[model samples]
Target: MRTTNFDFSPLFRSSIGFDRMLNALEAASRAETMDDWPPYNIAKTSDDDYRITMAVAGFSQDELDLTQNQNMLIVSGQKANAEDGEYLHHGIGGQAFQRRFELADHVKIMGASLVNGLLTIDLKRELPEEMKPHRIAISTDSALPESETKRIDTANQAA
Candidate 1:
């Protein structure tokens, strides 16, 4: 495999606490060059919801495994056994495969289902209350002491 050197000095200088992000990006770029077996699609179902569907034909739900560790989601499949009959020309692939997806912060897998040979995994981003955007109430009334207010007024008048 051909390797390319990327200069992250500029990014490192400007951003803090993003080492994981940069590493994930590098890993993703490397993984992108590999063959795409069992094609998949990531779709946004709602503002904070997403669904990832993979073509896992011939693999039973029990033969597949899904796991989430930190920010990574891993999916793997292995057929229990080959079909009893021999195939003259086998075309349908039921090979063992593994796929990994990097999840963003606050993203969590909601559920997963297998239907019609497709494995769909749902995800939702739920930000904590402290992380969510909030509006601070602005005070219209002054809370300064009378003496302090008089001093400010006198200073403004003198100016």
Candidate 2:
């Protein structure tokens, strides 16, 4: 048997609160599917719009739940055997599945729908004003006189 270890020490840095970041990262890493149970696709719709499409052939809208917790978007489903059928070939995947997606801050879920065995989830990115980049004005009179600068330096040296 062979074993491997995950190194998380590199995430810690000055004042960024690495623990919080590490927690989120750990959750994301753990959510990766070992088996492609229910395959999904995420696509950009427009400049600020996005979409997520998942293949949920046998599950209904009532069997699925969508939630946004913290910075994570979770989609979960459970099938309740709506009909009894004797199958010659059971190729369709009908088992319940839960899918998770980590979303950046201010990302919003627009809507979700199931059509032709495909589950489509729409999302939009809404950036906050404070987080957006803005230009700052520099004042011409903000510069100090040379004599004032020298006096401040002399005081610092004296101290």
Candidate 3:
């Protein structure tokens, strides 16, 4: 028995906007290289609410700061003391970390918290009706009649 594989060249060649898809794929591939140090979780708390939780074991509340600048959510943490005490054995995560998450348009940060060893950040997105896209009413007499069109043409020529 022989194994035969179907070719995908036709799909790639015929599809429109393949360049855009390729660019997006390249961007996502590059994003994989960035450090996701101190793994985190993003969950939808409610219809309009969201939360981000990061495992920050040794970092204190004072050491961590969360800020939203434009469309970027920046989380920065710096270890306070390099040598706190003389320990026979040390197995704790105590290193500076700065993580960046790109927020979509209209995504705003509501609040943040550091509880127990987890840093939880809350976010609320404004989903007003005005923000959503809608079609405008098209008038029936959209086209101008001959007399009014002639007047507009004369005015433009005079200017």
Which candidate comes out best when scored by TM-score?
Answer: 1
Model 3 scores worst on lDDT over the 10 consecutive residues at 1-10
Candidate 2 runs further than 4 Å off = 1-6, 13-15, 27-33, 142-159
How accurate locally is residue 102 in candidate 2, as Cα lDDT from 0 to 100? 84
- Model 2 TM-score, all chains together: 0.72
Window of ten residues with lowest summed lDDT in model 2: 1-10
- What TM-scores do the predictions have? 0.82, 0.72, 0.63
Tell me how many residue pairs clash in candidate 1. Answer: 0
| Residue 101 in model 1: lDDT | 90
Ranking 2 against 3 by lDDT, winner: 2
CA RMSD for every model?
A: 4.8, 5.1, 7.9
Location of the lowest summed lDDT over 10 successive residues in candidate 1? 150-159
TM-score of 1: 0.82
Off by over 4 Å in 3: 1-26, 133-159
Two-way lDDT contest, 1 vs 2, winner? 1
Q: Residue by residue across 67-107, what tens digits does model 2's lDDT show?
A: 99987899888888676767888798878787878887688
